[model samples]
Target: MFTPVHADFFNAPTLELSRNLLGQILVHELPEGVVAGRIVETEAYMGAEDRAAHSFGNRRTKRTEIMFGKPGLVYTYQMHTHTLVNVVAGPEETPRAILIRAVEPVEGIELMRERRGKHMPMKQWTSGPGKLTKAMAINMDYYGHYFTEKPLYIAQGNPVESVSVGPRIGIGNSLDAVHYPYRFWESENPFVSKFR
Candidate 1:
């Protein structure tokens, strides 16, 4: 019963798209059940010009090629053991992406609780990039998949009343690009990644 956001929605500038992502719903259709969450936080990485971007200076490898693909695709990769999810954004040839940093659980709460932890506090459940992915069952299997469709997709959800902007987190060596306030999150959202 969720309205899927159009691919054109993500074809805009990365920063704007990231800001607009707040309050959208991320849905996952798994065999066990449908899990969904309202996006509360996101970080934008603008193409190769941005030093923190994976495609920084055209560093396109087999892993990053998909980031250059069309918008509205899932660009996922493993960091250590956990899978991190991103929405491929910007124009067709640009390697831009918006990393979904946090979400507020909206569906399949019990499944999320079971995957994250039954005893953990609600904030710790989906409050971080790694934490939310685990809770929502996002994995590498979703890599390069068109997210404007089934399995994984975004839906229009609650409207963001306000947004907070800040520098991207955990990238200290990226030079001056680190100062760009590309991270967007719902103001005072407790579920936002702890770094916020």
Candidate 2:
């Protein structure tokens, strides 16, 4: 019964969103039922200067349009045939975002286990971008949707302290940009991805 308040959209800037997302609960409701997880790791992608970002250089295409939308919206894309989810950040047209890297399963554990095709321990249930989406039943169809309503949404949860920041992963081509410490996560969360 924890519904996300739409007011989260008022928060501008991807950096704030990246850090604030920690410990927030992400709920995904599908035909089967609801699956929920607590966000533990996130990466901020600033517009233009952040070379690892798709919106870098102000490049706008069919794929990145969601980045230009209002904040608190779900921006999803396909990678390796799997769906990746990001929360739009910054003001309108700013093209900033925070990629949800991992989560710790907190509710609907059975639905997550069934989606993942294995009985993973709670900590390992949603430990990666791809894994979390798969476990929550999110896909391209969810792109450009609102996170405060519909099939997927974010709800308030326990706040995390002792957070850490570091460079993003899997962006070898960005050179120095790859070293930008934009990733944020709960320091004690065991479900954080190993890439950090």
Candidate 3:
């Protein structure tokens, strides 16, 4: 049985939280059924000073206001046609967040497959940030939600034995921030995003 992680679970430093989430389960209790996945990859966005982050330079807008709130809050945003989910990290007033890049399907496989539509490779279902959110039915409605509660919450899973660190994907315009080794993933996980 998986136990939901409390708000304190996200109280760690942003980088640590990125790594710690490697093997955790991201559960979304949908009306159709419960869909979940084992987190395999993540990216850390150190707010304000981090040029690659949405809250860079402490810029606060309607979409980024949630990032400046308490840790463990859900920060969902749209990237093109897909909705990406992030876990608010760092202390209060700090806009740091960890983007959930990829996950390995755990529960509600049929539902996930149906939501994703058509029969494709299982790894391809949630191998990318946008793809995972689509498979799990996570959308803009989850923005500013708490990760410590039901419907959507993180749960304990297998411990990560080995981890790999690398630069995050995209955001090539962030200058030197593009080189930051802020991406963390489970070593040799096939479900991890293809970019790395």
Candidate 4:
């Protein structure tokens, strides 16, 4: 049984929340069934000043408006054909967020396998940001949703004994921001997207 993490669980600073998120369970209750995964990887996006962040220089739009909302708000966005998920962090108007990069299947594995196709290896199912969202059935519908609420929410899980940190991936154009050591993951976790 999983207990929903409260709003206070996300009150920590954005960078701290990113590391703290490791080892927590991300649960999504679909009409099809309940699917959950233990988070293994995450990346932090510092608001405004960080060039790699969507709200860099405070560029707010319909899409980024939710980022400026209260902590624990869900921020889902489309990257090409894939939809990725992020957890809103920092105080209101700060626009900071932590991207859920990967997770290890904990429940509803069969459901996730179906979404990812049976032929694919289990590790490949939720081993990346885009891949995890699809496998867990998390889409744009979850945008603006509160992580403290049901249907979709985070839950407590076993603590990660060792965490590895490194620079985030996929945003090389941000220059110096790309080299920032903001990515964190459970050490040696096979479900993590990539090892540092």
RMSD of 3: 1.0
What's the lDDT for candidate 2?
0.86
Instruction: Tell me the whole-model lDDT of each prediction, alpha carbons only.
Output: 0.90, 0.86, 0.93, 0.94
TM-score of every model versus the real structure: 0.97, 0.94, 0.97, 0.98
Q: Candidate 2: lDDT of 85?
A: 95
Sort the predicted structures by lDDT, highest score first: 4, 3, 1, 2
Stretch of 10 with least lDDT, candidate 1: 6-15
Model 1 scores a C-alpha lDDT of: 0.90
- lDDT per residue for candidate 3 within 106-145, as digits (tens), equals 9999998887877698889999999999999999999988
Task: List where candidate 1 sits over 4 angstroms from the true fold.
Answer: none
Q: Whose lDDT is higher: candidate 3's or candidate 4's?
A: 4
TM-score of model 1 vs. true structure: 0.97
Name model 4 segments beyond 4 Å from true.
none
Q: What tens-digit string does per-residue lDDT give for candidate 2 at 91-176?
A: 89998889999999888888888878775676666888998998898888888788888679998887797899999878889878
lDDT of 4 by residue, 77-142 (tens): 999999999999999999999999999999999999999999999999999999999999898999
Please give the RMSD to the true structure for each candidate, in Å.
1.1, 1.4, 1.0, 1.0
What order do candidates take by TM-score, descending? 4, 3, 1, 2
